[model samples]
Target: MRKKLFRATVLMVVPFFASLLIRLLYVTNKKVFHAPKSVGSEPIIFACWHGELLMLPYLYFQYRKTPNAKVLISSHFDGLLISKTIEYFGLETIAGSTNRNAAKVLIQGIRALKDGYDIGITPDGPKGPRHEVADGIVIMAKKTKAKIALFNVKPTKFWQLNSWDKFIIPKPFGTLHYYSTSEIDVSEMDIEEAKLLIKEGLLKHEA
Candidate 1:
């Protein structure tokens, strides 16, 4: 009985806390990425670091303003939580990984590109040696010939929770720095160079 009640309570409260956090963040920072006028109408593959996942929903929703945009997610429990939360924000998820069902997800991403919806990915996400970008985003961009946006976000203040990824949970009413750099040139990359380039970018950011 105790276990049953505990599970029930957690299910109820976890979502509440998630929603509360999202609302608080939405009200916090208003300045993030502004879609460029020329790039406004094209499909893009947006990449960001893993730690900033908590605040991504707020950013996504603000840009969407309507029902659009899709993200690639992993088939894991944490992905379950993020997928649910993303859906709650009216975004869609295509479940896959660099190792599992990757082709399917890439195809889905291509379809999204053709449909005029952009694909967003955490270059160091799902699981990570925190902030280490992976080659997956570049591979996807190369396949789809989609422009890449290196999404970046920083919080003025936040607690870095003790998780494998050191997830950042931004404080209520905090400031956030968000922007994206120009398209990552991935056309010449094979798997080897892609991996090296990804690590280089990660090191650049960490530096």
Candidate 2:
């Protein structure tokens, strides 16, 4: 009973603090958008590397006003923290990952696309051999024929975490150079071809 109560308190309190921190960092950062206007349309997949996931809620909100986005997060406890934190930004969460209950993840993603929700996916997330792209995102795009908005960020100042994805937190008052592909259609390509194409697009802005 004590453990359950502690977990509940963390869940309730941490996301509010985390979201506050993100908002603080975001408002202090000078962001440059190098993305096409068509990137955040409905039914699109917003793909980015796991390390660059920090400031993306701000990125999404900058372009999209409907607040109809859902992010693919792992079913782990850490993912739960993220799920709750992003909810503060008016984004929904889908809990599952490529390595665990992958079928459910794919199905739910396709369903969300059909319903016109743009999905935020960190292709190598929930765990990572950092910067590596996984195949699940490619499969989801092909299966649903959803266009992908692949993006990257170059921050002039930031702190990098020691986690597997080398998660970053952009320092206050710094500039963020943001770049994104207009749209990528993987419906006609073979799985491997599509996967490699996306992998390249995502890594383009990485140092």
Best by lDDT: 2
Q: Quote the lDDT for 44 in model 1.
A: 74
Candidate 1 local lDDT, residue 152? 54
Report the lDDT tens digits of candidate 1 across residue range 37-107. Answer: 23444677777777777766654554456757888888775576677666767778888765467678767
Candidate 1: worst-modelled 10 consecutive residues by lDDT: 32-41
Q: For every candidate structure, what is the RMSD over all alpha carbons to the true structure, in angstroms?
A: 3.4, 1.3
Name the best candidate (by TM-score): 2
Per-residue lDDT tens digits for candidate 2, residues 1-207, read 998899889999999999999889877888898888766455789989888987887667656876888899988888899999999999998999877898999899989989988888998887876767788888888888888888887789999988888888889899988888888888899888887888888888767
Which 10 consecutive positions of candidate 2 have the poorest summed lDDT?
A: 35-44
